[model samples]
Target: MRYLLAGPDDYSLKQKLSEIKLSLGDTALLADATTLFEGARVKAAEFKLTVDALPFLTPCRLVIVTGLLSRFQPAGGQVNKASRLEEADTFSAAVRAAPPTTAIILIEPELNRRNPLFAGLADILEVHEFPVLDRSGLKAWIGSRVSLCGGAIAPGAINLLAQYVGADLWALSGEIEKLRLFAGSRPITEADVKTLVGYTGEASIFNLVDAVIECRLKPAVESLEALKAGGLPAGYALSMMSRQLRLIILYLDLKSRGEKEIEIRRRLGLTADFVWRKTAAQAARFSFSRAAVAYRRLLETDLAIKTGRMEESAAVDLLVAELASGAGLETRELS
Candidate 1:
């Protein structure tokens, strides 16, 4: 059987691939198109394919191709006998003629429905791009991973991990694994994560907020540069940093109403640890009005980004500088 699994959701596609490969037994031959193409100059001396190469793909033979037709060839154009594509056609034709025992699995392939490969394949599987998980997916995925590891991910810890990791499943899965080892007989706790998992930039974006909240210029600048260096998207940097500013503003508004940390946490649906840590940070640093000003600038940054009035990265840089500068720059031009 021939198969194609292609999309931006590489993590899930990879998981499905692992299962499929295990099902294909010992006789499978896995060959990547790029690898073979690169090796073809040397390989041509030993084994050359002709129209006769088609029958060689036997049952249980697994050949993997990635980015095969996307960047590699022209569709329905006149096939030049001299080109690498013609060579690919020869291999593909051979696979088509082979028995059902042969499996051609393409990984993250970029083939159009109109392409020749589409006509040749017996089966097609479409995989979707995994969106950033919202609150519900986070809880379920954490619960599942925790159960598999012989423990439970505490209810309170979910929000801490969610706030800290955002929705990057790649990063979250690894963190969950580490917690499993550290967990032993203990239930996962926010303190355990603080000590073990550490504050990823996802969590530490708040540090930059706290820095700006305190108006510590140097550290705020450093934090912004660190996020950019990590190749964080300009929109993402602004969003996360902006969220921290808003959190401060919200915490302050509630605090003035004589709301205690626990009450504030419950009202916001914040996990206990987040409310304690974040509220304490707010109390130590900001007044409501100052936080409001910072948040408005971040809101402006958000607008400029969405409206395309400023280029994405430049908008983030400008906002970071504005936030980092200790003096209130609201009276000055931001853009």
Candidate 2:
């Protein structure tokens, strides 16, 4: 069996790979029969030899190659056109001639439709693309995941989970399992989700933003400490802070243009009413000039951490203090 598993939905792709691995019989025996090639740097001759080799002490073999198809993708500039075409043809022939007892799975995070290698094997490969889910799809997936884990969730809880986690299946799956174990015999409710998930990092972010915009130094420091304790990396926390400030600026700008609330929410892609309300309130409190200064400071802090001029933790602490102090607020008109 020849398969092409492509897409950015890594969790589902990995699940599919696991299913394939289990279908081959005993896990112990399959381990000996399985071969993995990680990168596109794998030579064609080496790949062919592995797939062509008979299974050792097993009925079948599994050959998994990741990023092999991406090497021939046109935008990468790794291989010239002529060389790509030749190598693609070579790989195509090898895939076609793979032994019936050998299951060859080619994996890529994404593949260009025009890639010669993908195009050549389109007819024979059992192609599966796992794109990120949309809103409705995410809701459905969350419900299904809960049920699959032997737990039921209320409709409101499903919506809340979808809003909190978005399309990151790995996080969604982990959250679902956590909720299932916590819910016991009863159905998971919106309150449970709120209590357990706590908006999946957004709650701390909101508190942090509120503290900084309100110039509440103690609260800002506490919120930053809570985020660090929750295992959010300093860089990610900084990015999220920047994102919130950007949203505040956007909300103010759109309101100034006389755009309606609904239109602004739609444009900003803020689907959750809770999130929309919070952002609107923050925008009301944070002037455009203040938000811009905070954003600029975040950028500088990011650069300082990346350049090793300041430690990530200390830099983030300083950024929170500087923003909370309203250091640059006097230079610009508050409005």
Candidate 3:
């Protein structure tokens, strides 16, 4: 039968894709559009996705078609607005005539619920877009997986990881396996989780923030080292910080407008914990004016790094110093 797995949660899509792979075992063939994205521009990548859910009815199978086909992969050449419109019309038609299969995969840029895809589906399992798994849902997902695998990741352990890992299921699951092997039959502990996975796994993007938040400048520097060693590019790392800070500013702005947290999410287009993280980051000790100052600093440094005036590693160092000053961590350092 045909399937339409469309949702705002990309991680959900990735997780489902992973599950499909697992269910099909080692023998099933998988094809996805992500590979083509690297070599082809948006308009030039000709993609019409169709897979016989049973490529051959003789054996149990899983045929997957990802949603990346509809997305842009950073076009290298000039505009072809005319060709794009034509492609959209063609793509829309293909979605209407989906084939039957034991399973079909859809993902990214969620299908419009009001659109025809939703109406045509035999079943639509509305997966909660879990960038952060709630307590109940966390137990359910982890519990079920444990039952399937004949072991548990433990509820307490799951929450501890969730505090840092959030809901990137793959990373959480990876850490779980690592912990499971380390613990064996013994119950997993937070210390064990930390000792094994450490902050590095869930820590890189946010380590500097935590360091800044807690006013630990030296740790921020060390975090810079860890992030770099972890193969996170300097510019991309700085960009993440910029995004966090700018989002904080946006959250604060909406909060000032008497917006409820949910309203802020709707207005800002932010997910739940993202909104919480921003509020938590900017709420205490730093006002909008202070955040604005820091925001401007990030903007300037981002440009300077892109233009080669400052390297991102050095920029992160400077930014941390400024944040330390902002949070009243060590004002004398900048002076």
- RMSD in order of candidates: 17.7, 15.1, 13.6
Clashing pairs in 2: none
Q: What TM-score would each prediction reach against the true structure?
A: 0.46, 0.62, 0.45
- Model 2 lDDT tens row, 1-335: 88888876677888998887888888799888888886456788988888888887898998888777766763333445786799889888888888888999999867677778888899988888876565688898998989999999999999877755555677678889999999999999999998988655786787788788878888788778878878898888999998999899899889667576689999999997657756865775566777887887888899999899999989999999988887766385433
lDDT for residue 270 in candidate 2, whole number 0-100:
100
Evaluated with lDDT, which candidate comes out highest?
A: 2
lDDT, residue 261, candidate 3: 52
Best by TM-score: 2
Which clashing pairs does model 1 show? 54-94, 59-101, 59-102, 60-101
What is the Å distance of residue 275 in model 2 from its true position?
22
Off-target runs (Cα >4 Å) in candidate 1 are 26-59, 72-95, 109-116, 119-135, 202-335
lDDT of 3: 0.53
What TM-score quantifies how close candidate 3 is to the native fold?
Answer: 0.45
C-alpha positional error of residue 73 in candidate 3 after TM-score superposition, expressed in Å: 14
Of candidates 3 and 2, the better by lDDT = 2
- Which 10-residue window in model 2 sums to the lowest lDDT? 71-80
Model 3 Cα lDDT, one tens digit per residue, 170-203 = 4556667777778778777777777886655335
Clashes of each: 4, 0, 1
Cα displacement (Å) at residue 191, model 2: 0.8
